[model samples]
Target: MGVRFLHAADFHLGSQLAAGRGESTDHDETLESAVYTAVSRLFDLAISERVDFVIVAGDLYDTDSRSVRANAFLEEQFARLAEREIPAYVCYGNHDPVADAPTYVELPETVYEFDHEAPEEFCFPNADAPEARIWGQSYRDRHESRSMYRRFTPADDRIPNVGVLHTGLNPDGRRYVPVGRRDLAGKDDIHYWALGHVHDARVFDDEQPIAYPGVPQGRQITEPGPGGALLVELDAAGSCEMEFVPTSPVVWRSVAVDVGDESISSIPDIERHIERSVDDLAATTDRFDGTSVSVRDPEWEVDGYVCRWTLTGNGPVHETLGADPEAVYELTRRLRRTLAGRRPFVWTEAVRDETGPPIPAIDDLRGTDRVIDEFLALADEFDDAARDRFRDEVGMLWQPVDDHEEGRPDELALTDDRLDELVDRARERVLGELARRRAD
Candidate 1:
């Protein structure tokens, strides 16, 4: 029989999801427990599959300072594996490095935590007469700039050799353990590289699998889709086959719905449009059973989605929405209520009004008058100047507020994307004001 095992990483336990922020007490508990729930499901799958062993690459906890509950949950899971005689190999990532304060809780005998000093090898069946060899190393501290890949010695080529490490593959700066695909791939003796740190489920090459099983549960809008572990099957010849199993209880999604020419004149119309969009999403999820049935399958499913809705495109109700922030908030609440009232519930975390006024053609007003010409010229100037100077201008307003706060910095840094947002808002506000004045 072929040797089978589960590959997973970046559990990030004790991490709080932003989706639960400002939510009801029960909702907050659900969101907080979602990560743990996903982890439990992963263990459940491992037990059911009766895999020989489980490999957890790293970041099992969000930080060294974990809650007692998080500690208890981990011990419970490891004990479950021990009961079935299935071994677990784990390495520590930057988030839960060796130098971090100990939890004082002992892991089960079935669990093998890699040493921080050097690469250690664990053999399946028995070390004296091994069928598979797994090598791994934990992080010595929170920041490991050097490449740990060099420390790994080649295992015997006769059996399936798996090398596990927590690294930031070809990262921009030195933060976590830095290593490259070629660095590990160059090792001929290693049949598989079980990687962690990056929270996006990826398989580098099928021949010698180098995979990151991402976070089991997405904790924010940025981590969209289904997060799960990889199941690897190794034949007697040592050839491998891999499959991903979805385990996240709740999926975080950011969806944009265009209501440009949909005759949406009021908040109710916008609400209906949003409801239809949610329905479409639900239908799509149900049709594929949460996994995308396309070539570019994101491997994300939404049994229950925490969504950030963006209303896009020019519409008649644009001015109405922009004019009243309270109305938009109320609309968001109503949308959330409407979605939650339905099956496969959706919680609308946020609603962004990206709609613009249905203005006349720019060509029609180009040279009509001085005000129009001046306004158009100013808009162009603003776009160009905003790119370079908007951050400084905004920082002046933000710095004073930040300074007053205890932990806030004196200067606020803005990302390129955030700058673009500010520029778009400025342009819209200018044009809207001009149009309103002209109408007057």
Candidate 2:
């Protein structure tokens, strides 16, 4: 018989979510609860599937300063697992280092939390198949600059070995337990490597089955799309099969709607367009639901969507949306209100106006050097300058406010790719202005 287990990490319990500007505390609380709800679904899945064990790579809690409620939630979930006779192996991540975890809250006997002081291995001997060994270590402190993988060595006995660690794959620095893919692949005895820290679910290798299940639920707009866990089945022959199981109640999505078409002229027309977009998103969810064939699994059903809308393309409506920011805000508010009254709700967290004025073809404006040509050249210069400014100055804004700050998170720094996007928007705006002037 095969050894079945679920792999997940970065629960980040008690972490605050990003709410819309001026949103009430109640709404923010609801968003926060959505994450926990997703976690509960994970435990439920373990019990329902009768998996022999569950592997939580790390970052169960968002921080050492986690709330009592978050601690209780974990205890309750573990107790549920214990009742089902399913064991859970967990390692502490940087966010919830072993040294910092509250001593008052106790984990259930069924849960095997790796020791922070040294690397440890737990072996489960099956009556009918080869024994399985799981090797792991917890974060001793918030910053483990060295590679933790060095401390781990597969057990001597010929058995199915699984390695778990909260690490990054050749990250920017040694801040997070950085381990190379080749280093993991070099381990001859280890059949699977379950990793954590990164929030996007990905598979590094299929044969040996190295994977990151990502965060079960996304807490910010930046972490768009469904977040979930991985279900792994390992046979006696040392082969592994894995499946991704999404568990997020609310999915974050960013969508761009082009308004260059002549039909989209007024705010109401834009509203209708947004309605169609929401319906389209719902239809997509519906299709997934139909194909999933499992109503009990939360991964199969998308309860709702939180979207960030970006309006693009050149038209008269672009001028209106760009000229009046309030109108755009109102449109977002109206869409949110309208969607709230329906099933498969969609909340518009933000609306960005990236629309530009309609312009004549570049071929027509080829000789008109003073307007279109001059603007294009200037746009090119601005793009280079913008990239430099962001690279140098923007990082300072994300630095720690003080040495003692605990809960303060690092600001999301702008990347070169993001800078290129901003430059593109700026170019469009400049062209739109020049075109309007030429028409006038």
Candidate 3:
């Protein structure tokens, strides 16, 4: 009664999209192996949906380049389709390993690799009924500027025609191989265009019903998002429908938290900030109808929030935070501990201090009453420079003066006169250090 098929492309097996530049090559290679897991998930999708056939548009590998392992994984995917009795039709995109040759890889017998020379019709003849026809083509090179569809004619008027390709549809004209809308539209043999190349999923030109399933998962910051494939279903009467099903085990998200003066006053505030960020991400993802947010706090207690925390920071915060400094460090550790088992939360110690201003100078004052006058004159002159150096120094200078005058009996030993002397000398130390560095 209907033709139901699963449409997907850009598997890029062993491509290592998740590979990182700073990571050891071994780690990148391990990430590459993760694709096999994603592929298995797709097989589950196919079996669960009970689709009659699966169409793989193109770019089956990250590149035409392959190692023994990549090739082996490729064979496994096709074999799985065959095991389920679902015929799979594969077309070679620019990155296909066999793009230039008719030679077959060790694929399962049920898998049909399309040709470049002409559109071949595959008739799936039901035991009790007539055959359903599907046509497909392959890209002969990495950049086939011309349309590969010129050779294909529609299926006989009696059969439903489905067309598949791996060429760039609306690709960036400058660098990518470009295929235009005009070229694909009004084609007689194409009922549905299962396309590939661009990694963002979308359906284009309702008249043609062409689609791009995007990459299954992101490889870098530029590609951050949920990555996966598409499932297409058609009725016995040949009416078609499709839905996107994500297969990525990991997700990437970018979160921005604004730090105002009030927010950084205490540990509880910082904890609340982080919690709110995770909550906001959850909300945004829900609104997008996407999977949960997976924080990647690489250099701080943020990236790889679950797997690893690459400690990164400047000055004190960078120095492997300690439990002695209030409860803030403990709070950070607690957040990491609490979010460990959560799928959407990943705690990385990539926290870097964006704190502004520079370190201030401490006082070098000692034994002399006349030092008060000297300190007063210098303090007036250095006040502006002290602000420019580090606000902490200026804040420290005023603390003793304020404390003693307030008659706080438990305060550290110091008079207003002594405090002024200390303040002036501290300013000189900071300025002198700056000058010394410049001199060097």
Candidate 4:
């Protein structure tokens, strides 16, 4: 019989998400709870699947300084796992740096949180004493630049050694804390290497099945898409099978639909185009049971499944649709119905400045030709580097204006429109310098 376990990491509880700013406090709590809920769901899976053990790669908490409520929530999940009698192994990632620190919930007898500096190995309960050694090291300090894997090697042949770590095989050189594939592959006797850190799910070298289960839920735009944990079944013979089971309450998606040449004379056509895009997400989910777009409060209800929508495109759609407040109203209503009570179905408005033809070929400015050229010439006098710095300084100086322009119409008028007056003064200064340089 193989050892089955759920491998997951980066459950940044207390870390705010797009839903944090939602109008529905209940929905916000529900969505956030969905992340913590995944832990129990996975534990339930362990019980039903009868996995010998469970391994949480790292980052159990978003930070060391968690709120009292958040800590209480963490305790609840730990208790649920204890109830199932399933054992859990954990290592601290960069986020949850203090592996040694103790908190409220009575630590589950089955839980083994790894130590920071050195690699600790623990064996599971099996008649064969299956050489399944779990070797893990923790994040003792915040910025551990040194390679912890250097201390790890494969287990004895008598054991089916399994190594669990929270490092990155960053394909690009620009990875945080830099770990490489060679470190994992070079180790002998290690049949399966469980990894974390990089949120994207990946397997390196094929020689050693090293994987990162990604995050349990999306935290930001970069972390968009469905999030989940990896279910790994290791046979007594040492061969392992892995499957990704998504357990996120709400899926984060950034979809861009092309509306370049779309003709939208009526609402149904617009609805149809959006329907196809939404249907695409349904097929991706493969469950076919989610919300559909409609123009009503609480939106259209279809079997309690709610999906979200974001429309994007250029061409006639922009001109025909952008200014129509009713279109936006109708679209929002339809989206709300499709995403009914899922709460934060629509996180952001789709950017649809796609109206009008391509910027016209460079043409002479009719009345302001001479002044515009002078402005351009003055703007070009400073090198690219200097101009960039200048632009940054200008942004900082006008920071108050930018901050106030978001929702207040009066603030927007005072900041953006009024700031242009100052900008003109700065432009004059640049032109004056240009003239002085030319004369010299």
Candidate 5:
């Protein structure tokens, strides 16, 4: 029978999700428990699927001064695997390097950690006659620039050979173990290479299969979706097949919304557009097909999603937004208040204003309107002195936060380019107001 196992990395168990924009209503526990929950899901998969073993490439913890809570969580999970007679292999990465220190919470005997001194081999089940051979090493310090894959050649490649490593995967990179793709392909005897350090899960199709399982849960908005692990099958002929299975119960998404289109003139209208976007996200299929990774449990169910919204496109709403920082901040607060209580709740992290004034072409309005033509003429003459005056007028917006305020506004840096952008926004506001009066 062929051998089966789980490949994963970058658990970062001790890290907590950032409080984006603000914390949610009735979901602080949900946010805090996400990382641990995801890790638990992976362990559940290993036992349920009855994998022969598990391999963690690296970064099992977020820091070398590991927290007792994180230590206990991992020990509990390892014990679960041991009960099923399934063993686990681990190599510590930069975040959790080997320091000649003992673990606070002892892991079960089924756990095997690779040495940091050099690349070492461990036979699966027993060394006398084994189904597979796995090799890897740990980071003695925070940085490992030396080549480790050069020593990965298996003594007997008759059975399947697997390599589990934590690398940046760029042969030229000096921080993480820089192993080139070509070098990995050259080691054709190894049927699979499990890699880590890059936090987005991806599979590279070389002569043999190489994969990065990525962080099981995202701590920040930049790392989106259900970060996960891989399920693999290996035959005696060194043939390998792998599939990605998401383990995160909480996902992060960046949603782009065109805030001030012609149809979106009111708060309710903007809310409708955001609601539609959320519905679309909820309805879309799990996104692994285009990535060329098969799914085992493709269900997209999750506790919730945190979204960072970018409001794009132009309309009359430019009369109130993007120019004054307060306008955008208030809009985000309004949105969060409206969307915080739904099932599988959607949290609005922040909203950016990229809107503009809704008006006709300047050339078209030039011949028909005298006031606009005069304003345009004066606007052309509004130079550095005028911009400096405008900056002085808006200087109060960046004043250090008041004791009454929840958070401080970003410091205003009115460089030449920024001044020009602000000047254009002022012009847009004037034109937009003029256009509204003309219709009246």
Candidate 6:
């Protein structure tokens, strides 16, 4: 009468975590195998929850090459699913190995991969007494441009209709299967759209729920926080209930320690600040709500944290932070030496010096000097530049708009928030310099 299933996507099985950029450590083993670990936990959760089926929308592999280990790993995990009679539905995405006919690693009988050529339909529990009708298609090549959803014609029945796609949505459907949200929402017959391609999970709470479970594991700093699959249940009456479950063993956290607000004056003070933050992170990781994960849950799933720290805000310690050119390097080494050995290990990927020289307010700076006022006025002119617009323009100019840019992506030096911080710091320095000159 009711169907319970797990909706997941972007397994990226052979994917490797970004490594060798920073100091080497014991956790390199953890980083080396994090993706595989997350996926193993995914199946473990599926068996524990006893879900009827699992939907893996796309990007099941990282590249076109056949990896013995990645393949063997899937075969093993899927076999575990088979032992429990839990079927996994799979499709391929841009980064998947489907660019050519795959010499797939032998998986279990329970793994039901959809046709890569066209949209096809299958009934859950069988066509004779179907509870759910599922339709999906896979990418035949690395570059898939077909609007596969257009071919979906679910049989006329009272059964719940579910649709699956690996799409770029409407933005640039020209390359990655050009189906839009409006179009997906317009399909009255389909009760749920299980989508992929986008690594960030998103859900629409319309009459018909549309969702992307995102990547089951985050591979880098950009793909941080709780990464997992969706637990979904649809009742006979067509009401759907969903919950996100975190499966990542390692979580990438962007830690913004405001040295100014906390009066963090020394390496010890900074360490204490970070320690408190880690305690908060660990205590609450298991309690993450789907609201944070709906676009934005745990085994309390963290095993370790890989952090990128940005020392923000202006303060007396800002000068202290900048006093030594190696200040950030030294502080980061301290954190690594202290925290990485603790339970649920904390590792520092890097430390950034964004802290600024503490200065008086613009209001105080104004009416004091004519040149300072003119400079402040000029800075204010650029303040009107929208953060969103700047990011988009910068991305278009620098980062290519394509699925799966080759190789590990370099860390983006400027983010929207980073841009704001830099602007604020610049203003602080200008004001501080002007004030010093005036005092002279």
For TM-score, the strongest prediction is: 6
Per-residue lDDT of 1-440 in model 5, one digit per residue for the tens? 46899999999989998747464478788889989988898998899899999999998999988789999999999999998899999999988899754489998988999999999998898799788889998888778777788888788677878888888766876767877878888987788898888776777777788788878888876567778799999876756778888888777886768765687776566777888888755522253455556876546478888887877556766666646668767777877877667778777777776666677766777756777778878877887888778768888564422111122333333455656766676777787677667756
Write down the lDDT of every candidate, Cα atoms only.
Answer: 0.75, 0.75, 0.55, 0.58, 0.78, 0.76
| Candidate 5 regions with alpha-carbon error over 4 angstroms | 21-24, 100-102, 283-292, 297-300, 359-440
lDDT of 3 by residue, 112-213 (tens): 888766667666644246445667777666666646566667635455567777665543342223566567776745667788776556666455567777
**Tens digits of per-residue lDDT for model 2, 347-415:** 777888878778766667666767687766666676566667766876755432211112234233344
Ranking by TM-score: 6, 2, 5, 1, 4, 3
Using lDDT, give the best candidate's number.
Answer: 5
In model 6, what is the error at residue 139, expressed in angstroms? 0.9
List of clashing residue pairs for candidate 2: none
Q: In model 6, where is the ten-residue run with the lowest total lDDT?
A: 287-296
Name the regions of candidate 6 deviating beyond 4 angstroms.
19-24, 99-101, 235-237, 261-269, 283-297, 316-325, 361-367, 370-440
lDDT by residue for model 1 over 179-291, one digit each (tens)?
66777788877888999887767677744767777788988776677778888887546477777788887887778877766488788898888888876553222112233
Q: How far is candidate 3 from the true structure (C-alpha RMSD, Å)?
A: 17.3
Instruction: Supply the TM-score for candidate 2.
Output: 0.80
Candidate 3's TM-score: 0.61
Q: Is candidate 3 or candidate 6 better by lDDT?
A: 6
In the range 1-440, model 6's lDDT, one tens digit per residue, is 67889898888888786632376787888888889988988888899999988888988778767577887888998899898888887877777736465665778877878888678887886778888888998888777778888788987637778888888675454677877778888887888889887675667776678887777778877676778888888754658887877788887777787777546678788777777877755522332244433322254547788888887776777877778888777888898989899788888888877776666777888878898888888877775456556676667454422333322564443445567876776777777788778777
Ranking by lDDT: 5, 6, 1, 2, 4, 3
TM for every model, in the order presented, reads 0.78, 0.80, 0.61, 0.66, 0.80, 0.83
Worst 10 residues of 5 by lDDT: 400-409
